[model samples]
Target: MARIKPQALLQQSKKKKGPTRISVTTIILCNLVVVLIVFFLFSTYRHWSQRSRFQTDNQFSASEDGNAFMDAKKADVPGYAVLNTSKGFVTVELFKESSPEVVDEFIDLCQKGHFKGVLFNRVIKHYVIQAGTAQGLGATEDWTLRGKHYNQLDMSLNLKHEAFMLGTSKGKRNDKGFELFITTAPIPNLNEQLIVFGQVVKGEEVVQEIEEVDTDENYRPKSSIGIINVSLRQKI
Candidate 1:
């Protein structure tokens, strides 16, 4: 019987050890790659969640009723407007106590027939029903009363964007004051910049009806919605 050489036995051991070492290294590398991928995915998800939360905080969010500031007893006594729309009439109670100047301007405009023929050109479902543009989209006749860009009045009180709340936007364009909108749902995010001068006291059903109207990409109602007339009345 021939005896195996010590060197041959050593060589056989080296060969087996080589494959085992390679297998171990490969497994380690694969595990490292998996860890990196998981970390990357976690980082991406965290970034997206933070961005989404910030947008939610800044953009439209439903809030409580606009009447929270009004005293129950005096709620019935606030001066109100009767907005006769193509759909129907919607009565709005103005917040004269908190926003005196803004309310005065709005009332004065109504009395002067500034909004009589104006149409609610822009309408968004569950958002707002915008109108008061002099010639609808772009005729350059906005801010008819001042004939200039409307000033941003201070928001006198903390008011919620409840359904039927009347609001106005502030910006550099001449149409700032001319464009008015009614909230179909609470928009807490708009509480800071937009003005809330009134709340619908009657015919809120009419406002909801307007929200149901079909609109274009620009939120302009496909079918016209004109303000047949608007009138102001002192609280009795």
Candidate 2:
């Protein structure tokens, strides 16, 4: 038998090591694949969970009993609008006919509890505290308000901007419902140009408190004016 040289023995060892290296690479690849799968599953599950929470049912019902008040035409006019803010309550009377689509969209959002926990995102001193726009990532989930179309009406109406007069939102027309502001001072420029649908009937003190909050250079409140709840009060 011929004795193997040290060099030959080393060469054999390298060949044996090749299979071990391949096995290690395969294990690493498998682990990476599993990690990717897990990440994808987690992301998909989270997306679906959020969607279910914000999903809205657009079904509107009218009373069958001979109560004409519940009819869609009558129901479109909200009896009263109230905003329970962290500072206090701000109430308004809805002007249904002046801006029917805008007012109805607002009422529907309130009924769905969409405004609860939202904040007044913008506040301008002696101007307004614009709330109803969703804060953070919550607003993107349900952007459609039952496919309502946006329309701009002529601002020739004889309405004055009062403390709580709810005006049309300041974005594109028909984008009125989710964004609302309560006037801190009378903005005459807005007269008739923006739909003045409602006026604050009560809680002027709360509105004053919100207007008095400390704000930053950009006029954003250092502390948020959070909406605790919003509901309708029976018309007197």
Candidate 3:
């Protein structure tokens, strides 16, 4: 048997081993891909969970002790509402950026046919036009899609109550949601007191017509001026 040199054996071992297959860059890229996938899944899950929770039937009501459940969720996208009234068609663009939870509650009610056939009960000439009430007045018996009532925004956004600006009814200061109103003139005093959730993007004339209608002593329309239907669609 012939003795092999140590150097020769080392060279033969190196030849058998071959070259490195994976580089550091490849490992790093793979890790990055995995991280991105995980993040995407997490975000998707959170979105669906929020949607489900918002659509649930667990009505949030204030206790007799005065502890109310507050809804605080940021808006995800802008929503559009089309009000088909006996007068004319009015379009509104919801301010999801400023009032997300309010917009969500409004859209949910619209989807559930809560606004259909509801009377534009109150109309103040040169001021505002109010609606979304089952009972003509500021009654608490109306139930929204969210619950018997809807959540009030915390009024964090300093949005002005300008012409065409949409605001929830100030029934007891944040205890009303099924009722809403739109201003026909700039009312700066309403700032920080109401949630300006939307604005009229089109059909300002329609809003004016509604506001100009003849009303009784209680601001109710003398004739039947009601909403035929109210629908909401996501902004494309």
Candidate 4:
């Protein structure tokens, strides 16, 4: 029992003890904060990555003719359609940039044998040849990939209806259906009045041959010329 002053006792009482042990609550709270932070960062990164990846896609430049086109440097998603007809096989280049959903629907239909044995119901000499029923009357039963004209893009990109152009038949303004057509000559009257989604890159002579086929007053080919089959593939 050494004599100690009250001030000394107070100082000793104020001395540091052993290190404080972290409680379970503190540990859990710290871990939860770390997890939340990681989750936020991860979500942000995924969003940025997706946006960056598709930013260049579906972009286009306006041409002098008011036609929309993806720059030459930018890669094009062109589809090559090899139409096997009674006359002959014709190759076409469908531009996805002009009409994305329409082109996709067309490709889907072709893959599912949509046009197999389908007649070119309407054929006009030196003008155009047409197929697919109005409003796609008999094209149902898994044939409709989407709603009727749900992806309506009329005269998309102001695509000109030039010679050998492929387009959808219109019943009314912006009311086009599966009825497709190919021009044997430049149908300037139909320019901006129809959606020009594709062009015959090769076998123009074949299309011309079909145009010259025998047709009645209603422009229906008398000899029953139509598509035997249609094959599609990727192009540059």
- Tens-digit lDDT string for candidate 1 (1-236): 99999999999988773433457889999999999999999999999999999887655432223344445534534398888999999998889788776777776677678888788876656556778653332343332321121112223434455567887765442423566778776555667546778888899889989988876555567899989888777662
Which segments of model 3 are wrong by more than 4 Å? 1-78, 134-160, 170-177
Per-prediction CA RMSD (Å)? 21.3, 25.8, 19.3, 17.2
Per-residue accuracy of model 3 over 165-212 as CA lDDT, tens digit each: 888854443223477778777654556435678889988999998878
Candidate 4: C-alpha RMSD to true structure equals 17.2
N/CA/C clash count, model 1: 1
Q: For each candidate, what TM-score against the reference?
A: 0.54, 0.54, 0.54, 0.53
Select the stronger candidate by TM-score from 2 and 4: 2
Q: Whose lDDT is higher: candidate 3's or candidate 4's?
A: 3
Mind giving the per-residue lDDT tens digits that candidate 2 earns over 1-236?
Answer: 99999999999988774443457889999999999999999999999987766453212222334455547667756678888889888888888767777777777778888778878775655566677653311232221210111112223444355455677554454333466767766655666335567888889888888877886654557987789999887674
In model 2, what is the error at residue 16, expressed in angstroms? 99
Global Cα lDDT for candidate 1: 0.70
Candidate 2 error regions (>4 Å): 1-72, 134-160, 170-177, 191-193
Q: lDDT (CA) for every model shown?
A: 0.70, 0.67, 0.70, 0.68
